[model samples]
Target: MAIDRQTVNRVAFLARLKIDDDKIEATEEEFNKILNWVEQLNEVNTDEVEPLSAVNDLPLICREDNVTEGSQADKILANAPMAEYGYFVVPKVVE
Candidate 1:
């Protein structure tokens, strides 16, 4: 559909945008150009084209989700001022 001055005014009001009176003509022309481009795109045949989540067909690089207890307890506790039973020793917050 072609964009008109009234359509531009209505759209601006609905979108809570302020288009200067002088720029309204330029804005309407830009909108018309975009619509014409979209109309041209609609004429292209894509009946056999498959819809894709991504343009490329590269496989997702993923690591195996292995469930296990962490093995870095010693390395992590080495930086702590004190550690006990494979846990960091922090001051008790509750009385």
Candidate 2:
């Protein structure tokens, strides 16, 4: 399908792109090429193909969800600019 200059302009507007007047012709040509390539893909037969969720067939490796170390509250709050009662203190935003 041949994409027109107006269609290219509308597409640019929808996509929030600023295409110069001189670039409209080039943009339209590129858009039409893309559309033609997509149209060509329509001719491919995928009747026997199965849809796959992931490209890799390997199972995902997971680690045990257990704490290896004890609590270090002082160490954690050491870098804080302002900490109050074992928690980070920030400027209140609500009036």
Q: Which candidate should be chosen as best, given lDDT against the real structure?
A: 1
Count: clashes, candidate 2: 0
For candidate 2, what is the TM-score? 0.47
RMSD of each: 13.6, 8.5
Give the clashing residue pairs of candidate 1, or none. Answer: none
Report the lDDT of model 2 for residue 94: 100
**Structural RMSD, model 1:** 13.6
Residue 60 CA displacement from its true place in model 2, Å: 15
TM-score of each: 0.46, 0.47
Off by over 4 Å in 1: 45-95
Going through the candidates in the order shown, the clash numbers are 0, 0
Give one digit per residue, the lDDT tens place, for model 1 in 1-95.
88999999999999999999999999999999999988997787889987769888899998788877578889989989989999888999797
lDDT computed for candidate 1: 0.92
